[model samples]
Target: MVDTLQLILPGFLLPYLDRFMQFGQELFGGAWQDILTVVWTVIKVMLIIAPLLLGVAYTTFAERKVIGWMQVRIGPNRVGPWGLIQPLADGLKLLLKEVTIPSGADKFVFLIAPVFAFTPAVLAWAVIPFSDFLVLANVNASLLFIMAVTSISVYGIILAGWSSNSKYAFLGSMRSAAQMISYEVAMGLSLVVVLMISNSLNVVDIVQAQGQGRFADMGLNFLSWNWLPLLPMFVVYLVSIFAECGRAPFDLPEGESEIVGYHVEYAGMSFAVFQLAEYSAMILGTALISLLFLGGWSSPFGFLPDSAFWLFFKMFALLVVFFWARATFPRYRYDQVMRLGWKVFIPVCLVWLLIVGCWMMSPWNIWK
Candidate 1:
């Protein structure tokens, strides 16, 4: 991760980033380095966060528009040109709206639940590799960090449901928690094969590991990525992520036509926060898919330049898949969801893990 203020900005623009450091040293004496370190860290964090917020906002817009096109209907055309400003308009409305607390709700937990949900969505990005250059923390155990952080968001749903004191909300949350946990088992196992193959826990290392072999040298690098070698696990991971996000056919949590969602009692910006968490999770999930399964920031064809553009392109493509799945599939029954996770997805992942393990040890090991 580029940690310092000087490191994050282009060198040409701030050829004298060190001058600020020098000036700080002069002004604050021995404590100047510490002060500048804090300032630089804050700036770096903001650079990641500000764009993420905008991306999350626009993701919602893209979802609506894409789904609309799939269903042959126009979406979000009222705010700004072609509804480009719809997300901002929605945010402003939510900001000005009142946050209402239910009669028996626990005020503290109720108010904090949204934060619990939102924090993990943003925190996971700290270790995400955007391209060859951009990343925040660059933790060696980034894959584990992501799993640990993302797993916390479910608690927010549970808390929201319990705090609301509504039977429908509570039931919805329980179902969601069960569904999310079940799918996570499959998701984790699929990634086990990835780590086993890469022999590293760092997500970037996993991507770099893909950027090798004969296909890469032949300018057919897409053939060298993990997805081709680990096809079954790739499919498992994709489906597992869909369920993890509570999206599409897996979106029984938000089965508003039937069971009320966990955030049923939330209103105004409080409600908006939950929405933010959901979309952010979608973006995060798509990003991880791009990095882990597809090559992160690398061109599919070796002839093309590797850049952040490919990462964004892959992320956008995955988002289209999300919308496509939503448009194409009807909601799975709660029982069916459980069955798919436990009986289907889990077994598939487990069997693939064994196959991958054996394949890795064989003389014919492609990864070697």
Candidate 2:
């Protein structure tokens, strides 16, 4: 169906497609005459994301199931197909529920916050580089673009917490803002090592760079992934991402146990928006890790074809790690979380950046 549409569609549906196909065919051996080929390509991407979105939806269900299994109890089995429809039912319920605006809240900003939060979460996927030649927007500074867009998402949480005019929500917002800013710094620094090694901010470049040289030549196999070379930075970045996403152990922003947290006053669809943003951000975090550390969409062994399979595999591994961290670790205290960010993770990332710098300059040339 997608192929048929692309073949018959007007030349100017998306001008960029024509240019990209021309560039690909001329430079990369892709077909040139049917530049609209990207239409079908885009359809494939959407097909991938459709399942991913559904997976993200049911991830909540799986989290409950797993947590339930850990606690020796049944989870959501009441909905259709052993609660397979629970996420859908949950969506319907949120849609049907009433959206109430607090009397004392700033109605406009309160409503706008979720939109701000949700937009960037989805938009970041535009440059994720799911596979070789398979991304929505293949920008030069894709990493920088992602970081900038994600940073903007913090404003949404801040607005949501502040506009609601609730003390707890305000506190949650403050925590969220501080957490995101601090972690973002560490996350950016960690990527410096990746950029330094790859010599490019384009994700595809980073992955391709890792493929050069043999094990004896580089002293390791494909396991010589950036994760091994920059292990400390990888750990710091992972921890920072948890804080950035406001996930468990670092979920102080929305610490339901202690405070109602941000979005405390949001109800129904408004609340659902916040949930969607959080899940989307989680998927984005995993995708970034896959791109940077796990060699984004590249096979682990180097012999397998570079395809979406590697992308999904790496992403799934990260997602499992996320759940494991959530299940195994206890939440950090507010002050402890702040201290860890400032005193620990940030400093480590900075030090590693310096180490990478020194390594780059030395005659050793570990990266080379």
- Top of the candidates by lDDT: 1
Q: Compared with the true structure, what per-residue lDDT tens digits does model 1 show for residues 1-368?
A: 22454566887757476676567678889997677668767877999899999999998999999999988999999999999999999999999999999989999999999999899989999899987668878889999999999999999999999999899889888988888899999999999999999999998899898998889989998999999989988998998899988898888867788766788899999999998998899999999999998989889998899998999999999999998999899898999999988999889888988998899889979787
Best by TM-score: 1
User: In order, what lDDT does every prediction score?
Assistant: 0.90, 0.82
Residue-pair clashes per prediction, in order, are: 0, 0
Specify the poorest-scoring 10-residue window by lDDT in model 2.
213-222
Q: What's the distance in Å from true for residue 111, model 1?
A: 0.8
Q: TM-score of each candidate?
A: 0.94, 0.86
Tens digits of per-residue lDDT for model 2, 92-171: 99999999999899999999999999888777887888777877779999889999999999999999999999988998
lDDT of 1: 0.90
